[model samples]
Target: MNQGLIPSRYAKALFEYASEHDCDKLVFERMQALSEAFASEPSLVKAVRNPYVSRRDKIQLLTTASGSTEGDSAMTRFMELLADNNRLDMARDIALAYLKIYRREHNICLVTVTSAAPMAEAEEKRLKQLIQRHLGSATMEYNHLINPDLIGGFQVSIDNEKLDASVANELKQLRLKLLN
Candidate 1:
């Protein structure tokens, strides 16, 4: 009954349905775009969540906004599902859950690296290679971030696993050691 659980459940059902219909990839991509649009457009979110708006009007607006997109059916079904469950407000959560399912099914991992300074191309390449070697797949996506508070060195995270080698982390460890 948790709010987040509802979206994930709906997303899982939709994923299975899409897979059965052989439109999983297309629907997943469309859902991702729709979710991003919904997140970026405050007006769209407001309109969708407005209780006074008729269901038909909401559907028409979504259809018009999506215009000529190839995955209209999947989106339409998803919208209807949300409306029926009175969960239109959680559309973004459903879309994100669907994307997470899609990525897991496709064996994709998102890796993030943060450092005090931007990494050189060669350094990035080396890190990518190392990550790929460790993950045993060349299908990793990397995001880089510069955080000056790190002071030096870098940190890497792949899903829930984290490697922190930042100067700030080292200093904290040293301070703790001395305190103990």
Candidate 2:
């Protein structure tokens, strides 16, 4: 079985179930938070995948990390289901899958831009326009970051697409050509 299949299936089922309950929005927000939590804390991933952690505790920790309100049936029930299946450890992947599904359904384009330094106002505006054009007719959410490691220029990631225009990338390509 493909490793990605499990999370995508679970995420789809959860999206449909929550939609039926008329709380898909809340579930979506919680899933976003869950994904962020996984990214920001390595320990959270460790705990979820830890053999020593109880299923109940794992669920509790996930709920808390996701900022799920007490008695939120949709979020709670989803965690419970994950626990019952011994799939709690896959929560991070599931959350990200859920976000992707939700964003697709809502026509939201997630744009991430990273540059060697902060982009000037005109550059930021140009990037936004480029993203808008790339994901035509979709709502765009843009995030910009600085990564000196790029050496210069910038990178843009939209959904599964990537545009790497950094100087480091150019140098690497040139080096490969010279080697060949």
Candidate 3:
């Protein structure tokens, strides 16, 4: 199995199932939580990836780690399927793929705004509006981050595209020009 293909296929199947059942939002949220957990708890991910772990045990650990067992039938079934298929090791990648599907289906754009200082509410609002105008017809998930090293100004990253207006970047460009 190709490394990326397995998780992508699994994610797409889960997404389609959720969409058909009108539970895509719920599953998407669950996948996001799982992805975050995989990122923060490398040990947990390692345990899941371990070939010796039984399917039942992996399911138990995953459900317990998620802190929810109160009738998310879709998620439960999905996890069981992954365990059966020996695809539990690809949980993180599946979650990532699920998120991409969710965002695409819901017309959402995840954007990060990094600046030297915290942006005021109005500034944030204006920036979001500007982004919406440029991107067109999508809801933005605006993540505001502060980086003192930026010196001043801000940078906006929408998906893979970056708009760099940071002072540090400008200075680097200036330095490069001078060197040239």
Candidate 4:
């Protein structure tokens, strides 16, 4: 089976379980924290992925690393399933997939706004409103980033859609039009 397929399958199972228990949001948040912890501690990730390490050892390490958060039986069971299926290395992917499912269920959309410079509070608010209007979705989360290379204006991305209105892009378009 494909690597992605495996994680997605596990994620779907966990999502359903969480939904039934009405703990989907909690699980999603916990998984995200775990994923970030693992990413920041590459040594731990490497140890978990090492085939030389026994399953029991890996499980012990995971339990210790998870600390109080492992109190959730669902998460504990999910960890055991990962170890049993030898898919522990895909923990990050599984967490991400779970977050995606959770967001979809809550009708939350993540939007990224990249501008040439830091945006004013008013500008940010206006841009967020514009995005909400365009998406026609009440639940929108905005993440702002600054990229001076853009020269001016901004670019916004919500899911698979992108809206670009940077000065650099406009200049390129003008140059192309002149060439034609």
Q: What is the C-alpha RMSD of each candidate to the true structure, in Å?
A: 3.1, 1.7, 1.7, 2.8
User: Which should have the higher lDDT, number 1 or number 2?
Assistant: 2
Q: Clash number for every model?
A: 0, 0, 0, 0
Better of 1 and 3 by TM-score: 3
lDDT of 2 by residue, 4-38 (tens): 99999999999999888888889999999999999
Model 4: per-residue lDDT, tens digit, 1-180?
A: 788887888999999998999878778777777776787888988888899999888876765555426467877887889898888888778887887877888898879999999999998988888888987854886789999999999999997788899999999999999999
Better of 1 and 4 by lDDT: 4
Clashes (candidate 4): 0
Candidate number of the best lDDT: 2
Per-residue CA lDDT of model 3 for 30-58, tens digit only, reads 88788878888889987997879888889
Q: Sorted by lDDT, highest first, which candidate order results?
A: 2, 3, 4, 1
| lDDT (Cα) of model 2 | 0.92
For model 2, give the 10-residue run with minimal summed lDDT: 126-135
- lDDT for model 3, on a 0 to 1 scale? 0.88
What's the TM for model 1?
0.79
Global Cα lDDT for candidate 1: 0.81
lDDT for each of the candidates?
A: 0.81, 0.92, 0.88, 0.83
**Which candidate model has the greater TM-score, 2 or 4?**
2
The residue-by-residue lDDT of candidate 1 on 116-152, one tens digit each, is 9998999889988898898885368678999999999
**Positional deviation of residue 23's Cα in model 2 after best superposition, in angstroms:** 2.0
Candidate 2 regions exceeding 4 Å error are none
| Residue-level error in angstroms, candidate 3, position 104 | 1.0
Question: For model 1, how many clashes?
Answer: 0
Better of 1 and 2 by TM-score: 2
